[model samples]
Target: MRKNPVFQNEVLGAAILQVRSGRARSRTTLAKALGVSPSTVGMYVDRLIAENFLSESGVRQGPMGRPRRLLTTLAGAGWFAGVEFHALRVQAVGVDFSGRQTTAVVRPLPAEVTADSVIKTILLCVAKLTEAMQGPLLAVGLGVPGLVDPQAGIGLHYAFIPDWNQVPVSSLISTRLGVPVILQNNLRAIALAERWFGMGHDLNDYVILGPRSGFGIAMVLHGKLVEGAHHAAGEVGRWPWPLGGGDGTSQELHHVLSAPATWRRLAGVSVREKLPEDLRAALVEFAATDSAEWQAVCADFARVIGCLQLLTDTEVFILHGPLTALGERFCESIIRAARALAPALATAPLKVVPSVLGDDAGALGAASLAMEAWSPA
Candidate 1:
């Protein structure tokens, strides 16, 4: 039978993505991971090598078999710009074809942020990266903070900024930059960062619990990101607190578990503009003390994790954002509370790991999006 060009392009793209993301390193592994025959993978690999999109690093000698050739992306192939912006700041990173970040630029948003200002800042940051890297920019991927229609390339709404509804952000940027632009929810983008380059790279199912200025989650089930019907699947922030409670006055998890809420409860501040040394010390002491308020906070976190795990059967819960500053003890407290809530959770293969990407996760995730969208064809 003959081959479809579109299908061949998809397979080729997947092969490149797997190699760039470290999911597969050889044509054999790539074929196994992609569910394609070795010959099919070889065909695409040869084409990619000819196109300068991939290269053979060396050979891996096994104990009792022919050495397997290692596959890797070529850095000079091209580059992509990834930008993640929120009410507070904008982060941009330049990633080569192999998914390695060449440089990152971060700029704080003014006290009053506008859509135009945000776009201008992003363009400026991309220009800086373009100048610094001196490589051809293939495309741009943007991680926007609120509801977004990724397929439509539109930002539906962002509560943080007024008049940030139904903005043609993707086209605006693409038109100005003269390249293709892809958009995704910021939290979901962070989840992509983990799935592509962080700890969740090897896992098929996991959750990224984001509790920074806001509370939300991004889930990966069966090696695919769950975008949901309305692109708001992990908007757990809007879930009512107290689990099954139906009290009309119950606060949303966003208000109860977010860093701002936690800080307000502990330090009488709603925002984390500058966590003073004394405040940081106090936070550490507070967690160590296990005071009533702190325990309540931990208990709330545990309930969220337990509920999500029960719903999704996720293997790991990667914690990201300001709450991570509380240290591993905080994670321990959540685990302990979850076990107390349900003894089964204690025996379950559940892991709560903190994110290693720090503030660059969203930016890196956006870059992954761009890399995934690019095709060698």
Candidate 2:
């Protein structure tokens, strides 16, 4: 006997997304967009409707005589929870099968949030959101600020949080919530969100440079994430920098790119202010100047990105975190520096942009992973 899978999961995923995106509402439109036979589309559509993943919402009266039936995803079929494991706070968001977010809440952890307390906080966040779900909460997606061993169901090393080394995180959550849990590095999680719904969606090769707590990088080459051996591909902090290197000085890439450090280096500027306007103004001042500190920061940025141009050859560079406070002008400077560093290949395909989804990126990425687990065939 021989068995071959129908291989309809990709089709099912595409159909669900097309309906949810309002791009292909009718079976005819879906088949045309997906470039599949009408019968193939009908088979999946009928199966999805029968399984309650889709519904005949109504009919759309087009310019022609006949009214076409419109289809929409059944948002109540299943739900997902996304949790971001921050050093000071844990945020949770609930998203439905139709990719609509239902709720989000952030719980502030106490000073020195420990591994045990982190689990408790996650449970609390999940409990708070699960109470409102109409359908089964299928899975929980977590984004921790550390390395995660997904196979071992453990968080390998939490950066800012204490005593999180080698903690059995997923097992703890699964025992409580009774659902599958997946964990990823926080920045890596955000990169996944960008790939699906943010700036990196259109390009096959791109890099996410989030120079925040630490200068981190995540790449998508040939439309797949470059998670290297030990799943530590984007750990750029360990790489040597600046054609002329440093001894943990201001010239070093990681030190110069640190968000709070750069912010503090701006003399007489403080993010702690009476209004957000004040902080934004300070950020603008940092970008609008040619001060020695600002130039040094840009130089360090150029060195790292220049090396990156040779390493990844990606087209887009996405800037987020504290540096984005300065806006697109700052990003432009970094792009120019990269071009100058590689004069021979001066015409590289490069576009520097900021993150669109902002604060919800981590949780949304986790939710996407959860949806992947429950996707229909």
Candidate 3:
């Protein structure tokens, strides 16, 4: 197979980014790490600077010669928009070149939000956010809770938002805003955020499980997000099993483990509004008890994790979304149950940790997608 020459540039760019992120190293240090000539490293750095992707800063004085200029990413060169739509709300965040979030807005959406209404709301939010940015917007990224085709910027299917099926979200948004756009599955986006800025950074392989109004999983292998042949690598919630057998596989996982589901399980309880502290406390207490309902939910999650682990060979599993955010104890319980059911194929210690990015993972990941798209090597 003929290897693309640009692949080498991409590798070098990624290496430079890693160094900038990790230690803010010099060109000589980068050359050492990349096993290349200092002059070659200088050429790459110069190109990056000319492209406005990188900048040099304060010099570090060494004992031998002149002060060395530190190379770093040009964070304010452009802005990226990140949007995440959930069943009940839509979140939009703007991130700068240095991966720092500059603005964030959250708004509630009606149960039956129309496509036009959603698009209008997104535009309004973007307009407001861009007004606050330091530079022109370079790209936009949208994360939807469904199967997304990044190449086409379309959503193939979304159980929660039926109207989103086959929606050319990227083209619609980009055309309206006059900027480049990228679309991604919400779970996959979150997984990417975890890999870049959260717990998965140190691990080469891991799984991110989000148990919210829907259940989804994302697998990262060899430090790259693994989207299968059809971009459906992490649809673990749809896996056929006793809980998700037959037509159930077509249903959203949110219907099984969401707050509404828990409220429904408790007779005469309403989950339409934000759960009260007392109600939250009660649910956590019940989960701690050895009740049939709690046991069933925990067992189902454990089963899902076990199945995913066996299939993906991932060493760490991150539990995310509202369910895990309910409390530390609740998350620990789920972790314990999953650990008990895990297979021995995992040679390294398995970590079932909570997501540090919380609900922002999707938005952050979307921003990252925009960065990758706008600044491709």
- Top candidate by lDDT: 1
Q: Per-residue CA lDDT of candidate 1, range 15-125, in tens?
A: 888888777988888999999889878888898999888998789987878999999988878898989998978999998877788899999888888999999999999
Number of backbone-clashing residue pairs for each candidate, in the order shown: 0, 0, 2
| Higher-ranked by lDDT: 1 or 2 | 1
Q: What are the runs in model 3 whose C-alpha is more than 4 Å off?
A: 1-16, 32-36, 50-52, 59-68, 241-254, 262-290, 339-348
Would you estimate the TM-scores of all the predictions? Answer: 0.91, 0.83, 0.83
lDDT (tens digit, per residue) of candidate 3 on 223-245: 78887899887776664556545
In model 3, the Cα lDDT at residue 183 comes to 86
User: Compared to the true structure, candidate 3 yields what TM-score?
Assistant: 0.83
* Cα lDDT tens digits for candidate 2, 1-377: 11234457767877887787677889889999888899889988998999998998678998887888999988899888988867778888898878778988789899977999999998999899888776988788888776777667788986688688999888899998888888777777777778666876567888888776667888888877676789777878655554455665424455546676567665544545233324435566677776777766766677777778777878877886757777777778777877876784478776677777767777877776666555564
Instruction: Report lDDT (CA) for all predictions.
Output: 0.85, 0.76, 0.72
